[model samples]
Target: MKNELNRNYSEVTEFILLGFRTSPEVQIPLFLLFLLIYMVIVAGNISMLVVIKTDSRLHTPMYFFLRNLSYLDLCYSTVIAPKTLATFLSRGKQISYNGCATQFFFFALFIGTEGFLLAVMAYDRFSAIRSPFLYTVCMSQKACVRLVIGSYICGCINSMIQTGFTFSLRFCGENRLDHFFCDVPALIKISCVDTFVNEIILFILSALIIITTTAVILVSYAYILSTVLKIPSTCGRNKTFSTCSSHITVVSLFYGTVFFMYAQPGAISSPEKSKIIAVFYTLIIPMLNPLIYSLRNREVKNAVKRILFRKKSFH
Candidate 1:
């Protein structure tokens, strides 16, 4: 019976993105605004990566994870921002089926990778704070590399499964997507067939990724807090808090929006609200990550100053 419906409904080859539709007067200003955002995202993430690589002082596990994060932000922003910018400038914002699937694949991949990477970073902080003498041994170079590689592997596996399931459904309804990008919820909503199984899989995957990572982060911070409070000196506690504050801020911002978007029951989900939340995680968060880290961390500021001073002397 379902097969009959699937066969009868015409398959969708392309999708129209109704991205933040607004008055004609607002379009150019919006375009310019996003253009500036994309530029800053590119320059900031890349510059942070360069600083981390060039400075030996940032060779620790925390900075290693941070470098991975900056790289992830760069890739994540590229996946959505360029296409979004194109949609703003052009009359038609159409994406082919394959192109849409490819976009979702990478988007999901990076998102999953980031979730686990944040957990790994939390563990790194736990080790540094709880076992300062053993921090080096606990988060060894080999261990760090393995953890990073494992995060990417998990992301790839999850993306392959979700993207395969999502695209396998027959999209027979209107080809227009309410959101800017090829998001899972938007795609699932447009499918002709019952998306019960797809939704189930999405829920399971999202719960496993988000809940597990959030749990790990909470646990790490719990122990970290205990350790920090045990320190007798107020100065030591302040320094310890400073080290983890930026990461905590970033995690809260990323997970808050993500959980709101993906973790909600379908009945209560509003497309408009989801799109607005999507903007935060996809665009705003990436732009803010470098700023948060650099501004909050004294070491990064010093490193940047040293790099600039060296260039000045060389010239």
Candidate 2:
């Protein structure tokens, strides 16, 4: 009987995504605002990719990892945002059972990959600052590629586990997901059977990924700080610190919301808070990332300037 409950047959073919219980007055404006954010997210990320690809001077392990970050943000946002925009316009806001699972799968995969990449970027910064003499050998092009591949593999494994676990449960009762997107917690809320196992799995996985990656960032920065302190000149230390500042900003914005969304207990208590947190990470972060890097990263700013100047000169 216990085994049968885990595989409980789904009477619900489709789920009504009860996206934001907003008044009719606010719906269109909200939809338009989100639409604009999505446009910026798409354009800004593509611009970053283009700038990275064209500038030979910007070709390095740092920029390479950065390119992947842009791509990751672009993708995961696509998975969540468009559907969300559609949900706002849609009175039905209905998604198929399979569709919800697919959304969660891709979201988990890209997001997990991104978390690991940030850690890798932190370590790259560490290597450069700690061993300037051996930086090239330590972070060879081959090594960067290997690290990226490993991140994706880890992401895929994580996605498969969570997606399989969430969808395998028998969703025999309520089909209304209280959130805009198909998140694990929202899905678990509607499950007919006991979600103790699922809750344990969710807690364990989120903890492991969050803890391990955050540890890497903390350790890498500690070493980086130690090295930077040894630099004789204030200007040199400032320059080194400036390079890391953008990454810190991006990490704080992403991890803060994610930490709240998953690891925190308050998140489960209030569905509205969870949706707002989702908006920040899924919509706002993607849009802000390129702008953050461009404003803070001298190399990226210079690259943009060179591109614009060439275009101006051509005309």
Candidate 3:
């Protein structure tokens, strides 16, 4: 009987991900729409990464973080995009056990890194704006690289702990995940083993992430605002505001969707609601990030114009 039971358990290899609705009418349209979105997102992020790498003027600490952020956005989208694109076509969404775990691992890592990276960028801006004389000393190249590396390392460690806890849970029978992606909350709900420990750890991690990132961003912006107010020239004020506004907007969009999705009570968050928010985080934000930053920053525009002019001359 024990051997038979072990065989039955081992036979469960794949998991069915019940992604979105089953209506034929909706699936095709959604697939086309998400395909367009995925293309745009990939293109936008790649362009930003290329621009940062090629442009000498963008070698500052702020742009360094922006480059890292672009990379993170690319990675963050990759974790969810292909699977999401496939979902629009597959009659029933199916993700293998190992595949799901891999998704969760990278997803957690990049998203967590993004939070820390944004905070670091905000601090960079704050130092530049508030302590213009000390900006170089404060955000030196070595220091900036170290900070970004530290953020990535922290994210990796945090993700390992979370994924480790999640993987430790014994999944017995029900293999159907109600949502599109392999999210922690959705996966934990169906675990045959107790998830109390997971919940507590998740809560602690969530609180630490929110509190630490929020504190850093808030303090940075507070200093920035103070410096902005002191600027006597209207043009200077506007320029400063324009420079930071795009970053603020992207930050709000990314954090707002994440906080809303995770901080809310599970009882009130339906699968449909989760899908809507996930769309913002996974697709829309990645696509818009490059647009927002490039359009607002004068440096990027001039670089693009020069690049296009060079192309024209060559042709």
Candidate 4:
């Protein structure tokens, strides 16, 4: 009974998200733009997933990682984009407190998962490029599956820890969140209780994740570059460089937005400023992912062509 009473009084049922600004001029344009972007992101990621799933040619370790990345994009967008779109349309942009926390929890989950998965992808590339003779042995079907699973598992655990800490914070006053989504920094700013410990924990965790993932990616690319340079055939070197370039571009975009948004202290990282940067990772990147990979990859293009031809024949 004591625990129930404390829970009932302690928990906040709702929160107001200040959402960019309250002007009609801004809201309409923002809404339309985000809606279009959301559609494109969903369409692009889904197309990639479908292409990978149906095509026999794409049943390789690389495409498997790409498929997982696409899936993560879908999950990541779903966590924030719909709510953001709704907030734009609504005059009163209020979300239930539980709802806000829930959103943040899932958002953190996928963001962390993507980071780890990207690192795994980097290692996969490293193995492929640096150890061609042992590449198949190193990245076997069982190993790839385990690596992907491990990334997600680690992400889930990390998110749970972060969310638990975030929820323990007290927010009795100023319920308005400065950002569009229920981000940790925005939420922490409005907490009525002490937030020093929470902020430190979050900061340390964020640093660990970004630092570890970036280090792995950088090291992998270094070895990859060395191996590519050692190729005796110019054509082979060119092909290897081309393949790694797309992955590197995607990884750079992902980590760049992440570092800009979360890797700094709140004193330095402005919520308003970060929100703009956040759009790249949240909306634009997902839409661009399929285009970057598909256009660059001959195998994906051929699969797409075959699929289109099959549709024409059926008609």
Q: Rank the candidates by lDDT, best first.
A: 2, 1, 4, 3
lDDT of 2 by residue, 1-315 (tens): 233463456577889999989898899999999999999999999999999999999899999999999999999999999899998888899999999999999999999999999999999998898888999999999999999999999999999999999999778757899999999888887888788898888888888999999999999999888888998999999999999999999999988988988886667668999999999988899999999999999999999999999999999
**What are the runs in model 1 whose C-alpha is more than 4 Å off?**
1-7, 266-269
Return the clash pairs for model 2, or none.
none
Q: Is candidate 1 or candidate 3 better by TM-score?
A: 1
Give lDDT tens digits, candidate 4, residues 83-129: 99999988788999889879988988998999999999899889988
Please give, for residues 108-158, the per-residue lDDT of candidate 3 as tens digits. Answer: 999899989989989899889877899999999999999999899989988
Compared with the true structure, all predictions reach lDDT values of 0.90, 0.91, 0.84, 0.85
Between candidates 1 and 3, name the one with more favorable lDDT: 1
Q: After superposition, how far is residue 3 of candidate 3 from its true place, in Å?
A: 23
RMSD in Å for candidate 3, one decimal? Answer: 3.2
Ten-residue segment with the worst summed lDDT in candidate 2? 1-10
Provide backbone clash counts, one per model.
0, 0, 0, 1
lDDT (10s digit) by residue, model 1, range 152-223:
999999999999999998887478988889998888877777888988898889888999999999999999
**What TM-score fits each model?**
0.96, 0.96, 0.93, 0.94
State each model's C-alpha RMSD to the native: 1.8, 2.3, 3.2, 3.9
In model 2, what is the error at residue 4, expressed in angstroms? 12
